[model samples]
Target chain A: MFEKLARMDRRIIYAVVFLSLSIPLIWPIGLGVTVGPETKELYNTVESLAPGSAVILSMDTSPGGYGELASGAAALLNHLSRQGIRVIGMGFFDTGPSLLETAFGGSDFKNKQYGTDYVNLGYLAGSETAIARMAKDIPGSFPRDYRGNLTPELPAMEGISSAQDVALVITISSGTPGVPEWIRQVGDPMGVPIATAIVAVNVPNMTPYMQSGQLSGMIPSMKGAAGYESLMGTSGLGIRGMDAQSISHLTILALVLLGNVVYLGTKSGASRGGGR
Target chain B: MRRELPVALAFAVGVLMIVSFFFTSEPLVEAAKTVQNWGVIIAAFALGLASVNLIQIHARRIIRGKGLDWLYSGALIFSMIGIALLGIVRGPTHRTYQFWFDALFVPGQATVYAMTGFFIASAAYRAFRVRNLDAAILLLSAAVLMLGNVPIGEKIWSQFPVIGDWLMNIPNLAGQRGMLIGAGIGGIASGLRVLLGIEKSYLGGSSS
Candidate 1:
């Protein structure tokens, strides 16, 4: 058994991981997650917002990271809509506006009025430069919404000319010109509270911002999405995927432990055999 | 003259942006806003230029290529041209344009990202061997983090979340803050260098 384990093929490991993730996803075990402080912080922030408050939802990720971020975006949107917040959506990434369209369709935002309750301001060209421009003059930066409607004409855009006019800025971000970009361009300079639904890889990078109060809140990756779902008392994709994520985590742990055991065993045996 | 012109422009623009940030002088602020707006338009043009560049390189590869390289290049060119034309004519919101984007691009990119999990699992099995004290510490931390991140960890012990919180909030926060501060200073230094014309690489040449 030890010998077979020692020479295990990479394919077997892959197959095991695939099954571990898939089986749990197909039939969930309900190993739900705890709502972390960051997720709660976001919830509290949104909860405190007055109705008719304007908030910018910037989609700063492509489809590659969107799969991971979509659940969190939906959860955040759910709260935003319930709070009657006026959502002014845009994307720094070209894919952002398109994805925002899809996210809105899938979310409760669909039930709300388009121009007044929410509007997609579409994709901007100049990454961080675009963000900086938008900070000073939102209507000037966008000019036209994603659907080719005049942004200034939209009821949601009324009285919200710049970042300072908004209550909060939430970026569903995955890469560069994301959280850090928002922090520098809008958050710090204008003093608007910034929040994010970010990718897992970026969660570690964002901790300091959360601690320093530079970022008011964050929904971190899938786990954060799951936590947000739990807090909302609705089981969405985030909650649905948590079982799979948990099982996968355990599966990787097992692999790592087995790996170390194999190493120790092999090393001891080889040393006894005169460094064979 | 070309080199001198771009360098001078960079310096002026950089100085203008910095000035707009610190001072609220109306003329300077308005000028900076105009420059930023122009930066956006230029960026849109850059995207178009990038597409043309992609086509030129791939078209060359398709002609003077070897083995399966020509096939790959041809496919890339075909996809790029087909999608670009379709998007141009029907608009990106058109059903057919969206169909291709949704059916092909999104899933293809998502699959590529998802496959990393399998590779990571396999790598962990073969490469996560404990060799020394440092290795053991790393392994321990990795285990704690993995367990703490999920529900089962709490099921095993409630303190898992608390410890994980401590790990992230204290040590992780400290490291991230240090890096952010250092990077911020480094970025300002580089920005100053460009503004002072001490860095001319932006003009497609070696820094001075």
Candidate 2:
């Protein structure tokens, strides 16, 4: 029995985990979220943005990370919309513009008119170099918007020529040519405040930047998304997913404990047989 | 002359970029901006270069008609050209392109990412045996972190969140900083090697 238990097929473990994640997602337990200090800082930074101030929302992730970050971006967008801040959307990744379109289309910005309240400058081909050029000359770098309209004619592009004109820059990033790239090319060089909503895997790597005061705020993964949603008084997918995340975590921990127990038992059993 | 000219250009450009940061003179800054713009243009061209390379490799595979390789190669080529033509004709914001991206591409990527959860669970079950003190500590930390990052941890015990935050803030931050600093130093050394023409591997061959 012990051997069988120890040698349980991985398929069973996968099934258990899938159920652990899926069931809670279906019927959520609505766990109360404890807001992290970083998430709170992100919320406060956007809140503190003066009305009519423009902020660059750089969607630098593809769909791989979009699933994890979309809710956080939505919550942040909702907050930005409430504050009536102008958002200039741009991306370094090719898939960035499409992700931004989905984000904007799904958010409270549905009612907001494009070219007025918000505008997407589209996916710039160059990664860090594009960021540097945009910092120097925004209109020069992107002559046309994502929708094929001239950028200078857009209302949101008015009075916004470079990074200096913007109040803050928020990068929703999954990988390289992202937050660090932004900081190196635009934020640090131009003295613009930068924040990020990144995938959870990058949280530890980015925390030091937050500590060093390079990043003004950060939202760490889906849990941070849930915390931000709770603060906004709007329960979105992030809040919904927390139940699943919690259950999955517990399930894995239980599995680890069980595996250790089996290991110890097997070792002791072998020792006793040897003694006999 | 082939290597010397490229190395000299790189050395000059690298030095100018470094100088632009500290000096900030108008002409120097403008010159740096021009170089940066050139970099962007070159990067844009590199995308086209990559596409051509991808097509060439896939086209050869399809021509060879190797086992199942041709099928995948054909699919890849068709998808690439089809998507590109669609976008070129109708623009990316058009319904057809958006539909393909949103419906087909997004979910496919998300599904691939979501499979990590199951893999993690299975891997943890098989590998996280507490064989030694280091392994035990690693297991305990992973468990604590997993619990603490979610809302349920606070429910179980507030201290979990507190301890988790400490783990991330202090030790994690220190470790990450050490890595970042090390990487920065390595990058500078590599850059110097390139500038001095000591690193010719980037030129497609070993340094003499």
Please tell me which predicted candidate would have the highest TM-score against the true structure: 2
Interface RMSD of 2: 1.1
Candidate 1, residues B128-192: lDDT per residue as tens digits? 88888898888888888878888888888888778888888888889888999999999999998
lDDT of 2 by residue, B1-208 (tens): 9988888998899999889878869999799889988998898899999999999999999999999999999999999999999999999899999999999999999999989988888888888898889997888788889888888888898888889988998889889999999999999999899888888877777776
Q: How much is the lDDT of residue A229 in candidate 1?
A: 91
Worst 10 residues of 2 chain A by lDDT: A1-10
Candidate 2 residue B181 Cα shift, in angstroms, is 1.8
Assess every candidate by TM-score: 0.96, 0.97
Candidate 2 wrongly placed segments (more than 4 Å): none
Cα TM-score of candidate 1: 0.96
Cα lDDT tens digits for candidate 1, A215-269:
8889989999999999999999999888888889999999988987887888777
Misplaced by over 4 Å in model 1 are: A1-3, B1-4
RMSD of 1: 1.6
lDDT for predicted candidate 1 compared with the true structure: 0.90
